[model samples]
Target: MHTAPQKFSRALTALAALTLAAGSAHAAAPSYVGTWASDLAQCKVPQERPEAPLVLQEKRFDQYETHCTFSSAEGAGDEWKVKANCQVEGDAQAYDFTLTVSGDTLTLTDDAGSQDLLRCR
Candidate 1:
């Protein structure tokens, strides 16, 4: 007992809902979900000695060797933010960092400065 216009409207509404669900399902994974090595040159780290590589393992997202333990992480598109407790020198510090990734390159920004890293193969 539906008019042509009513049927069309219902179909349009169903299509819209399906589109929204598909969009959510297609959300991209966080780009920082892998191991990265400091690009000493781009990061401007002193050439005296190379910096230790960083590893962001799955699930827990614990960055090995960097002394960073992320408690919460959120990602939207290519951007990610994490709240972490990290050991700097010998002191434990709370750090929040924003990261952006493009291709094999990732840039991490924090209170100090931004550093560029390359994905580890």
Candidate 2:
């Protein structure tokens, strides 16, 4: 009799754990839907006197929270573009950068081994 109750408790615990896992997956990644400007100090390379600011346009698609991506356009005389999936993990939001995130920043490494974004607005 007692064994039956123990099993029921275990089952309930498992169900709760699964639900929490799924919730985190949803929470970890969020839809990107705003215009973010660049923070100069967050960049891998500092901007020169004659350079324009970097701007990013984050858009969500199909109302799916996890299926959103961001397109970044930098103002460094030439047309530079970077793409990444955006998400919110715990208390921090990240752009993924196709690689890593440091603090409130995302690092984009190109084929040429260069970090694309320093800070996202």
Candidate 3:
């Protein structure tokens, strides 16, 4: 038969294990921390105009064809609000965009419209 003190010790040990497991399970992925490629089909783009792949770094976004360096990006719920300076076709412009991620898919919304992108492998 286990003594009262022995049972209490086992209970405390189990509680600690459960706490650690819960903490790890609730840990969330950082906002916009991966490479994503546009799903042209999902965006309903013309076959002739293929979208480029996008790679997001700590404070920069690179689309192979174009590059943008963000001044700030903050997470709000499932979305991130970003302010960036982008260079395209040799012209630099200030841009603001919203990014939302769900599962393996990410949606970027700007002045044009929303474009869905899949996480790159």
Candidate 4:
């Protein structure tokens, strides 16, 4: 019972809705999901070494002698704060840190200081 133009209009509306859904889904993903190192050259180091890239997943981050597991990341825009339970040098620790992303670099600021990491391509 639909006219040709009417059907086309419905299709366009559906397409726009679908496009918006896709964009929102992509936006919901955290931008900092990747393996990162202090520099690109550091990516070549073995995981056992201090110079190894840090591997960050949705719920965890791992480096040479440090690992942290957290429930979630919370923030808007380019910065997110994470409260993580961590293990450093075999000692359990709690850490509150902020992760900021700029292009292919991630800067993590903790109580110690800020460390800049380059995304491993």
Candidate 3 residue spans exceeding 4 A from truth: 1-29, 40-51
Q: Which run of 10 residues does model 2 get worst, by summed lDDT? A: 28-37
**What C-alpha lDDT do the candidate models reach, one value each?**
0.71, 0.42, 0.78, 0.89
Q: Please identify which of the two predictions, 2 or 4, would achieve the higher lDDT against the true structure.
A: 4
Highest TM-score model number: 4
Sort all candidates by lDDT, best to worst: 4, 3, 1, 2
Tens-place lDDT digits, model 2, residues 1-121: 5698899999999999999999987753321222222455433332333233343333332121233355543322223244545542223233423333444444445555645334444
lDDT computed for candidate 2: 0.42
Once model 1 is optimally superposed onto the true structure by TM-score, how far is the C-alpha of residue 90 displaced, in angstroms? Answer: 5.1
- Report the Cα lDDT for residue 45, model 2: 32
Regions more than 4 Å wrong, model 4: 1-28
Q: In model 1, which residue pairs have backbone atoms overlapping below 3 Å? A: none
The window of 10 residues in a row where model 3 has the poorest summed lDDT is: 41-50
Query: Per-residue CA lDDT of candidate 3, range 1-121, in tens?
Result: 9999999999999999999999999876565667787653433332234365677876888764567998998885568999999997668989999999898888999999998888766
- lDDT of the structure predicted as candidate 1: 0.71
Off by over 4 Å in 2: 1-27, 30-97, 116-121
Cα shift from native, residue 32, model 2 (Å)? 10
- All candidates: TM-score: 0.57, 0.29, 0.62, 0.73
User: In order, what is each prediction's RMSD in angstroms?
Assistant: 7.0, 13.0, 6.5, 2.8
